[model samples]
Target: MSPSTQRITVGELAARFLEQCGVRAAFGVISIHNMPILDAFHTRQKIRFVSARGEAGACNMADAYARVSGTLGVCVTSTGTGCGNAAGAMVEAITAGTPLLHLTGQIESPFLDRDLGYIHEHPAQLAMLKSVGKDAFRIRNPETALATLREAVRLAQTPPCGPVSIEIPIDVQKMKLDLPADLSPLAVPPVQPNLAAVDQLAERLLSAKRPLLWLGGGARGASAAAQRLVKMGWAVVSSVQGRGIVPEDHPASLGSYNLQKPAEEFYETVDALLAVGTRLRSNETLNYKLKLPATRYRIDANALAHNRGYTSELFVHGDAEITLNALADRLEGRMQIDPKLAADVKRARAEAASLVDGTLGQYVKLKNTLAEVVGKNLWWVRDITLSNSMWGNRAPVLDHPRAGVHALGGGIGQGLAMGVGVAVADAEHQLGRRTVSLCGDGGFMLNVGELACAAQEKANVVFLVMNDQRYGVIKNIQDDIYGSRHAYVELHTPDFAQLCASLQVPHFKLADPATTRDTLQKALAHGNGPVVVEVDMNAWGPFAVKFAGPPKKKEEA
Candidate 1:
């Protein structure tokens, strides 16, 4: 065949387009619907495809991969049931605002949107995808497949970024088209700030003595600008997603302890509060009832974010990086910053640490032990569990923006798969970093099959399963608020050692609190592949203070 006759199928176009856009890895479960695209990936051998046990696991893996790698994480799935299976994970990505691309197969063009019974057909699948993600698209014409993919990626990486999905029909995937000459990535223009608005914010903050900066998920890309603000005597506090934006070890960094008594009290004294790219979510703000500084300013790419969470005195519409750098440029050496602000921040941080330390009980040892072993560089991934709620979120203190990954949407059972994604991204970037997924027995069991996937990929991850033989948080809530009448919280505990043996993965059990360090070390030393370290929470006992549920206003409590 002549060179002009060698037309490319949509499957091959997707493969080549992703590679051109710098996508080094993708996660998915292979099925007949998506076999064509997977075949292209296999034939090209450019993007590393991670085969997860389930669609949920695959999407969760992609979410975590984007978080760790700071790239466009990709996931592929079959049509109908398979696409629906990925919705929960897609919601998590949307909540975290991760830049991810989800590609799923669809039924044949002839059978499209028909109510008649057909295999792998979901009537309104595109609507479902749009509901769970930032945006969703369907490739109706084979000729526009590449353009649709490019637009999806552009939207996913745009400011206020989130996951975007594209559904291509199996028949369309097989249709041949002339390859586009240009495969370069789409260019998304930054949301530039209004200089007048930025100047007004700078002027208002110029007289402030105690200025505070609240960083959130949207500010992750502006770490360098945030650091400059810190150097200029701004005290830093972050939401969970914003941890490490200013290096938690910095004396002025509050490190997600924003709602702790010490930090809340400190907020009252702050004369100026500059909230950057944060939603000030209910979880972190006591459902919007927490008192904040009287004078507040907010910068965000999403204009709607201005007055939704906590009303700001001035709202600057722009990307976090651009607005922050512009603010720093205007305020440098001009503001009347307090000389003792750093000391005040240090005192607040110390008090917050003390408050958390008093509630760890025997697990304080576990927290400290893990800190010593994992140090600051290890990638910390967590699910919603008793352990993470207690200490896992703020323990070791991450130093880089990408060093932390967690279910920002408060989902359970995503950590195990997220760990696999983190490990894959680590390998692809040759970062040589180890990942530890902190999960509860209940959540771990939810995605237990993914452990096999981790083992198969030889992912560098340690699954730290905190086994309490129940849904500890639900039980705690029931005890505190429901007259101690436990219902379905208790679960039949599994023998993790036996389970690990079946998967040929190394396992270690830490029943004694004293063995926390040793067990973690041993698991970490199993460097070749995944390892499971089960912390016997039942044997070890309860925390010093019970976290029944999220903190609420005094009236709600």
Candidate 2:
């Protein structure tokens, strides 16, 4: 056979395919069932394999890598339990609509359906994966393995993107097969928008005196179009996952302070609501009870996403970037925006910022310190902590869509792993940025073992642990609803400085409220690896607003 048509193991071919797709790094644990694939990766040395301590952390890393780098994030895992370990992180990727390719191993082909209880056997493994992933595929033969891999990547990168899982039996991965002479990755074409619908929406937008644009994670790719709309005097707000679609500092951008009082007051005056590429999820909209404008319209790539939460007056099924561009073109010179509406947006934003500052109290100082040190070079990654729920999600102004990563699924303990992934991917892309993951004491301890992985990889990440010595949110809930009878919320935290010393990672503690800024600056300026910065939340005192109680209902309003 010619060199171009040489036979190679399926595992090697898979690695080569990933490399051709421009994948620079992958994350996962090594196991016997997946030895062939991992061996190939090690031998080629073309792609860096981040050895994570757990499958869940690996998946989180892959998800964040995809978000920060704007590429297909690759993750590999072994059979059965290994794949099960990644299920939670897969849910997060699904919620955030991250483009991720999860490669996993399966039992031998002969034992696949027998339920013989093999060492790594699992009942209905493929079905379980299919339920969690956007799509799941199993490679039954070596000859078609490469094609299957390409299809999985294509699907993950398509519009309405999410994670895709592919499993190859151990025998299949080791099988030798002849690859096609022209084995290149396939490029998926972008979806187009309907021009007629765009014109109709443009006309509606032009007719409204006070219109607002709501951006979601899916709108990240359409930042230019969003900016154009904002420039036309349409005020903007974002869902938590949708932060940074428009730089939060923009006069028209409201950030994630949508459910607050000042923003709610501004919403009262809005006549038109143009939502693009967002689910308008209940949590962000205060359980879908936040009062919006009377005339509502939505543009989404997924046709099924229409009317998922709150129903819109007009639902346009199309790609957000394309639709916005078409709408902007149609409304070119025929639009006139009210000056009063612009002034109102600016005033409302200032008021909201002040309120958040007052609520944050001592944490407000930390936030400003971060902005001063990192400026726009920081990638704000957060776990589900009180600090994040209260301020981190909305307070910071991310200059770019890729600069913010959060646990959209509302899960904790994934932030450290995600931050490491973001840092590594950013370094690979030469973005020259630092990833700061804000975690609570409880969340940080959940996957604290992953700190070793960060040390090993020397990932440029700062893990800021807000040590309240307990589940602050849960405690607040008990105080409000259960008359201060707290149970199972108190937690014991390790001396983070000592823990970091054991891992050979830099460590800092912010025990003094007055020295908070200096301590944070020193931690962030540390070497290119994971650093643990523990903030004494107790010293900072209580927050002005408690976010633990049940969301206020629309009927109450």
Candidate 3:
């Protein structure tokens, strides 16, 4: 064989492929089944392999890494239970449409799919991965390893992107293979929009007196295009996953207050609704009961998204970035949007912000304090918790498309792990940015072990643990509807100071709500590694507007 195409283990080839793909870092727990691949990573020292404490945390890290870095996030895991552990995180990646590659190990080729109870072997592991991932594949032999990896990455990075899982058997990973001469990764272009449809939509939008644009996570790549539409007097709002596509602080933006009373009222005056790259999810749309404009249009890469949740007058199947650019090109300077629309949007946003501030009650200080500290400079990562559901999701306006990273799947306990990933990405790019992860006492304890990983990596993160010592949302629901007979709501919360002490992480306690800003500043001052700030929510008092659950459906007369 030529010197340029020397024989090497498939494991080494996988590592080289990832390097060629410009993958800077990967995350997962190390295990014997996947040792070959990790060994290759270690030996080459080309890519940073983060050793997470659990497979789930590893996968979450990878997902957030992809979201923040705008690249294919790689995760490695062992076979069977290890793969199972990563399943939930993969689901989140799929929900968020993150471009991620999940590489996992499998049992030996001889024992695979035999159900013989071999060590760490799983029955139909690929099927489980398929259920959780956008797609799943397996390398049956050494010769097919590169081809399988290439296809998996392609499918993952394509439009309507999502996590794709590929399992390599232990034997195949160790087998010798000839390296390909051309190791550069393949490029998959975004789906082009249908120009005729784009022109028709542009004409319709031009005729409207008041037009609005709804952006979602898929719209992140189309920020400039979306901004142009906004500049043309189009009011804008976003789904939770879609925050920061256009800066949340933009005058015409309603932010993620889609279901708020003022925004809902503003929607009635909208003559044309162009929903771009958003699902119009049930939660944000008040279970699809929220009334929108009469003329509604949708643009998305997935053709099946047409009429999902809310029916659209027209469905344009193409990538958000591509289609919006085409539409913006035609509609520029020609739109007949109402002159008062921008002022109305501003009024609505003010009302919505007032409502949120009132609901925050004593915690409004926390929100404002964080806004001062984060200030579009740090990555805002939050898990599904009462604080996030109440205000964390909206406050502290994100200016850039990649500034916000949350659990889009509504999964709890993901913030800490995701914070590590964001910090890693921040450091990897040398952006000098830090991460502020918001968590509740309930969710913080779920994957609390990841704190060790954060400390070990010396990640730049400030974990704001809201210590209420109970499932605050559940208890609120009980109070509102279940006669306050709360069960499974109280938690045996840990002393965060002692916990962080053991982990060698700086710990701060915020008992006085007035000191919110100072406490956060001090946390950020601990610049070298991860720090935990436990907010005493019990002392902070309750929100003025109690969030029992989703809006109650009105009874038919």
Candidate 4:
């Protein structure tokens, strides 16, 4: 190892690569199989490791982190059962399309799959990953490790983004890297949608009686584009994963379409469908049964370039930002918004507001309170609400980077863990901003161990636990849909504020809605170790309407 050659350990090199990728936080229960990687993380002062109580919690934390921060969330676990245990979350990350980088330590390379003496089903573990998405790979050689990770992150950032899992061996993780001193993280190319397609699509949108625009996480970095569409007389309907792409308060917004009824109505009324930056997945598009009329256009960077199964009159390969820009330029200040349509949308919003009392009302209040404290600059890292909300990302009624990997599908425990990652990523770029995470009691309890990571690393995080004393969504179904026959849903929670205090951190419990503002203000206003505002939201709870409106038929997108 020459001095000029900059010989670093493989684990350290891996950590450095992740660091360059703006990976500020991680989750895992350090195991013998991954001690080298864990040690590498410990040495890297810039990155923080959130030691989760279980592998599921670790996976969920990474998923949430990616969703919240618009960065690839990270998680690690031992081989075999560990990876299999994290499979549910891995599947979630894949389903949700969260950009999560999962690391699992495999058996030593000596045996070489001979089944010489394996303790668990290694093949089955890796098989689960391959079955989920294309973003899964094995890190076999130290020589190609950095470049491999580079490509993984790049693929993750691509439109129709999903998870990327890297299965590294214990021996491989320990090997020394004969690599460069400094390697910048690979940057994803900004997609530029064809202006002609945007113009044609815009024209189609203008002609619609009740056109619908379904957005996915592809619009995470494309907020300006959504705003422009709002101005162009489009009845924008954000998919569950596509939540927060637009400010929910926009009058033209149709809210999120995740249930059977509204989603059916969404597609039924559509004269033209603009499935922008989405894959129209089965869940988002509901197995593509919602029939879109002959008049519709699909715009996806991948779809336009390949021209595969996508049925579209016009397809554009480009970034939402670029496409929106192209559309704006093509529009030349021409908009076709109807006054009556705007009024109708407002009336509907008012009606929805009235129906959203009790538990849902508390969610609205939670959303509003956070918005008030964070204002325009703060980003809300959300997880539970994505695939199951009427508002999706658009419900918040505030302008911030509220795009989580909700659509990416990492794991349930990722909300707080991912928030730390996003917050750290922002801090590195001097993007001095506040990020708050709204994890339900189920979501919070899943990743409670991350609180210690926050305390240890002094991560400036404010985790607001919507402690509803139940898996409120399941409870909602029981109460509203199933004659109140609730079971195995409600939870008995520990004193989360005390939990934070025991971790030697600042904490508060918000019982009164009036005091919530002041309590939240204090938590958001400070920048020490992480703080927790355990909102005992006994007033309201969680429910599931639909993950997103039904996907349009093949002709739609």
The estimated TM-scores of all candidates read 0.98, 0.97, 0.98, 0.78
lDDT of 4 by residue, 48-107 (tens): 777766787677667766666566788888888887777777777776667777888888
lDDT of 3: 0.90
Q: lDDT by residue for model 2 over 198-289, one digit each (tens)?
A: 77787777878788999998898899988888888789999887888899888788888888789988998999999998998887777888
lDDT of 3 by residue, 1-557 (tens): 66677888989989999999889999999988788899999999999999999999999999999999998999999999999999999999999999999999998999888888999998889999999988999998888888888989999998789999999999998999887787677789887888999988887777988898999988899999899899888899998888899999899999888888898899999988999888888778777888888789999998888999988988899989889989989988887778999999999999998988988888898899888876787789999899899998888898888889999888899999999999999999787767999998888898898899999999999999999899888899899778989999999988888888998999999999878888888988888899999999888877778777656346510
Per model, how many backbone clashes are there? 0, 0, 0, 39
Over 4 Å off, model 3: 2-5
Residue range 425-542, candidate 1, lDDT tens digits: 9999988778999999999999999999999999989999999999999999999989999999989977999999999999999999977887888889888889999999879988
Better of 2 and 3 by TM-score: 3
Relative to the true structure, candidate 1 reaches a TM of 0.98
Candidates by TM-score, descending order:
1, 3, 2, 4
Residue 69 C-alpha lDDT in model 2: 93
Query: lDDT of all predictions, in order shown?
Result: 0.91, 0.87, 0.90, 0.66
**Cα-lDDT of candidate 4:** 0.66
